[model samples]
Target: MTLYPVEAGNFKLDGGAMFGVVPKSLWNRTNPADSNNMIDIAARCLLIEEGDKLILIDTGMGDKQSEKFFSYYYPWGDHSIDKSLKKYGFHRDEITDLFMTHLHFDHCGGSIQWNKDRTGYEPAFKNARFWSNEEHWLWATQPNEREKASFLKENIIPMEQSGKLHFLEREKDEVFSENKELGFGVLFVDGHTDKQMIPHIDYKGKKLVFMADLLPTAGHIPLPYVMGYDTRPLLTLPEKKKFLETAANDNYYLFLEHDAHNEIITLKHTEKGIRLDKTHTFNEIFN
Candidate 1:
């Protein structure tokens, strides 16, 4: 299996919101903020090449949203899914599976796009089977008031409408399950959102985990630095602690999706608890 870092795009988010309750004085040291109090963020998706399967983990924020709508995020990069795919000598049509970690706009927005007529939405990757769990599908479709803004209908419904959506079966209340289709393990955690799947891939004798919203960046390494976007901040504390402890013990290479600068990271059990051991680029480790 081969892994490539597919940079979808880059943007800035409110530093305060990204690191909830954690004072600026502490967070700014790790994730320095700009004049407008915004911190750099990347929609860094991962592309996996195994046999004939080209599995894309997440699709960054698509370009379908209106300029006025995008202005709020302050986008700052030229990377696109198509362009990134071409860089590694592939195309969207060749993708067999589009496994979404969750249904947030920034994670799966690129899965659907405006049709040629520009009047309606259509599946962006015509040949890919879009993947999501039954629990998350229901939660995202019938979103609560707090998470309604994150779960956009335009980015989701079209996959089902196009008859290409499939759910990974999970036994009742199972937290971690093996996936036959993707040939990896998926850990379901509800602290960030309902049934958010974090893929754990066994590659090159290392456990590479896709850190979705569970740990947005290295700055959030501390236990209390959960994101304001998380629906259950209190739940996040213990969930993160358990994940980090395992990550440190197992020597997992955390594939960070939202951190603009740090692509991958490792943790060590220090006196202060789980702390960043080292940072690496995808090529540094894989090459």
Candidate 2:
């Protein structure tokens, strides 16, 4: 099995919102803010290539939103899914599975795109079976007021409309063991979003956990830096604490989604609790 880091694009988001109640004095040291206080964020996705299946985990926010809509997030950079795929000699049509960690726009927007006629939306990955759990599917489709803005309909509805959406069956804490096809286990996490699935991939004799919003960046390794956007921020505290302790103990590599500068990180049990042990690039760790 081969894993590739797909660069979807870069965007900016308010540092305060990203760091939640954490003081700027602390987070700014790791993710510095611009004059407008927006920090750089990457919509980095992962591509898993096994025998006959090419599975993509998360498709960064697509380019379908209006200028006014995109202005809010300040999408930047020239890196795109197409370009990244081409870099590795792959194409959209080759993907057999689109595994979404959650339905947030930044994570799943690339699942669909405007049709050629511009009349309606269509599945971006024409050949892939889109994956989302039943719980997260419902949570995103019938979003609460706090999360409604992040779960854009255009980015989601088309997956089901295309008749390729598949829901993974997983109860709380259930782990999907490594299989020859996917080469990974899936751990369901709800603190960031209801039933968000975090992929536990086995690569090169090491375990790499895709850190979706649960641990957006290495700076978020601390237990208290939960995002304010989470519907239940309180639940994130213990969830993060437990996850970090296990990650540190097992020497797991964290694949960050939103961290612009850092791709992977490892944790150590420090006096102040679990802290970042080191950071690595995809090639550094896997190659």
Candidate 3:
């Protein structure tokens, strides 16, 4: 099984929002902010190429949103899904599965794009079966006021409308379950958003986890460093605590999704609880 780090896009977000409640004095040390207090963020999606399956996890912010809409998040990079895919000699049309960790605009935004005529939105990857769980599908479609902004209709509905959206069922009380079709286990996390699926893949004899929002960056290794955007920060505490502890114990290589600088990270059990031990590039480890 070959795993590729797909560079979807690069953008910047408010450091305060990224690191909730945590004092700037603390988080700024790891994720330093610019003059506008914005920190660099990457829509670092993952591409899993195993046998006949070509699964792409979390398409980054597509170039469909209006300039005014995108101005809010300072996008500053030439890296794109097309360029990255082409770098690895692939294209969006080749993706068989589009597994989104959640339906947030940044994560799933690239899943849909304006049609040739720009008359309406359509599935960006026409050949792909878009994946989202039943619970998250409902949560995203019928979003609450707090999360409404993140769940955009244009970025979501087109998949279901296109008749290619698929749901992964997680039995009640099942924290981690294997998806035979995707050939990986997804850890169900709700603190960030309802039922955000974190992929746990057994890649080339090493355990690699897609660190969606559960642990956005190596800086978020501490238990108290949850994102402010999370619907329930309290719930994030235990969810992060449990998962991070397990990650540290199991020696899992965390594939960071949103960190612009750090690609992959490993954790260690320190006196201050689980902390980032070392960071690695996808090529250094996976290649």
Candidate 4:
């Protein structure tokens, strides 16, 4: 199996919101903020090449949203899904599975795109089966006022309409099938978003976890640093605490989704609690 870091694009988000309850004095060192208080974030997706299946972990925010809509969050960067795929001698059509960690715009937006005429949207990976949990599918479709903005209909409806949408499990307890050789185990996290799936992959004798919003960046290793964007911050603390303990015990490598500087981080148990041991890109660990 081969892994490629597919960087769809970069965007700006409020650093305070990204690191809830964490002070600017602490987070600014990890990621400095611009004049607008927005920090650069990468919509970094993972592409898996395993035999006949080319599975894409998440899609970056697509370029379908209106400029006025995009004004809220500035999306920048030259890297794109196509460019990342091409770098590995692959194409959109080559992807057999689109494994979404969740349906958040940044995670699943690239799953769908504008049609040729631009009148309606269509699945970006025409040949791939878009995977999302049934509970998350329901939650996102009938989103609460707090999360409505994040779960845009344009990015989701296309997958269901195209008949490419498939559910991993209905209940939050059950996740993807466990195939030891596949090296990818799904960890369902609800604090970030409903049933958000974080893939724990066994790579080169190392346990590598795709840290979605549960632990967005290395700076978020602190137990209390949950995101303000989370619907349930209380639930996030325990979730993060449990995950970190396990990661520290297992010596797992965490792959950051939004961290522009640090791609991978290892956590060490500390008196103050868990702390970051080291930081590096995915390639550094894999190569």
Candidate 5:
């Protein structure tokens, strides 16, 4: 199997919100903020090429949102979903599966795009089966006051309307596994968003995990660096701790989605805590 790092684009968000309770003195060292106090972040997506299937995990915030709406996030950078795909000699239509970690705008916004006629929205990848957990799907579709702004209906709905939406069933008492092959396996995490599915795949004998929001960057590997955007910050603490410990012990290479500079990180357990052991580009692991 081959894995590709798809550079969707970059956007800006408040550094404080991204680093949760961690003080600016700390997070700012890793992710510096601009004069406006917004830090640049990458909407880096992952492409899995195995056999006949080409799966894309988390489409970046698409270009369909209005200028006024996008002004808030400040989507910059030359890389884009279409341009990134073309970099690997592929196109949007070649994607067979669209695995959304959650329906948050930054993660799934590129899944749908405005119709050319401006009549309505349309599926960005017409041929792919869009995947989201049943619980998260409902949570995003009928969002609460706090998260409503992040879950835009225009970015969603069109997949279901296009007859491409599918939900992964929940195994309440047991962690879901990929006993049956369907491209890759999904690890459901709720600390960030309800039932956010992190894709775990075996690429060239190494286990690579698409770190959706679980570990947004290498800086977040430290137990206390959970994001403020998470609905359940307390829950995220243990969820992150457990994953970090496991990741360090298992030697899993975390593929970050929001990190502006760091693309991949591997952790090692230290006396202080789990710390980043190595920082490298996606090609180091795949090429």
Candidate 6:
């Protein structure tokens, strides 16, 4: 099996929103803010190539949204999914599975795109089976007022409309360890979003956990630095604490989705709490 780090794109978001109640004086040390108080955010996705299947985890924000719509969040960066895939000599059509961690626009927007005629949306990965759990599918489709802005219909509905959407059956707090076909176990956490699936991939005797929004960056290693975007910030506290404890104990490498500078990080049990032990590139760990 081979894993590739796909750089979908980058955007800017309010540092205050990203760090929740954490002060700018504190978070600015790790993720400095611009004059407008916006911090860099990456739509980093992961590509897993095993035998006949090429599975992509999380599609970054696509370029289909209107300029006026995208003006709210400044999307900037030369890196794109097409360019990243070409770097690895792969194409979107080669992807057999599109595993979404959640349905947030930044995470799943690339799943669908405008058709040639510009009449309607179509599945971006024409050959892949889009995977989203039943609970999250419902949660995103019937979004609550707080999360409605993040879950865009154009980014999600097309996958199901294309007749390629597949639901992964797992309850909250359930871990899918018996599924060997994917060569990874899925841990379902609901604090960030309902039934968000984090993949626990076993690679070269090491455990690599995809830290979606649960831990957006290494700076978020601290238990209190929850994002304001999280629907249930209070519930995220214990969930993060518990996960960090286990991650620190087992030496799990976290693959961050939004961290612009850091790609992977490991944790250590510190006097204050679980803290970052090391930061690495994907090649450093997998190569």
State which candidate has the highest lDDT: 1
Which residue pairs in candidate 6 have backbone atoms (N, alpha carbon, C) closer than 3 angstroms, thus clashing? none
Clashing pairs for predicted structure model 4, backbone only: none
The 10 consecutive residues of candidate 2 with the worst lDDT sum are 172-181
Compared with the true structure, what per-residue lDDT tens digits does model 4 show for residues 57-149?
A: 999888888899779888776889999899889999989999889999988998898999999999888899988878889999999999999
Task: Estimate the overall C-alpha local distance difference test score of candidate 4.
Answer: 0.86
What order do candidates take by lDDT, descending?
A: 1, 3, 6, 2, 5, 4
* Deviating ranges (above 4 Å) for candidate 2: 171-181
TM-score of each: 0.98, 0.97, 0.99, 0.95, 0.97, 0.97
TM-score of 3: 0.99
lDDT against the true structure, each candidate: 0.94, 0.90, 0.93, 0.86, 0.87, 0.90
Model 4 misplaced stretches (Cα beyond 4 Å): 170-183
**lDDT, residue 143, candidate 4:** 98
Q: How many residue pairs clash in each candidate?
A: 0, 0, 0, 0, 0, 0
| Tens digits of per-residue lDDT for model 1, 53-150 | 99999998899999998999999979888899999999999999999999999999999999999999998889999999998999999999999999
- Model 5 TM-score on a 0 to 1 scale: 0.97
Better of 1 and 6 by TM-score: 1
Give me candidate 4's TM-score against the actual structure: 0.95
lDDT tens readout by residue for model 2, 128-232: 999888878999999998899999999988888888888876554554434344567887777888988889988889998998998998888788898877878
RMSD of 5: 1.2
Cα RMSD, each candidate: 0.8, 1.4, 0.8, 1.8, 1.2, 1.2
lDDT (C-alpha) at residue 105 in model 2: 94
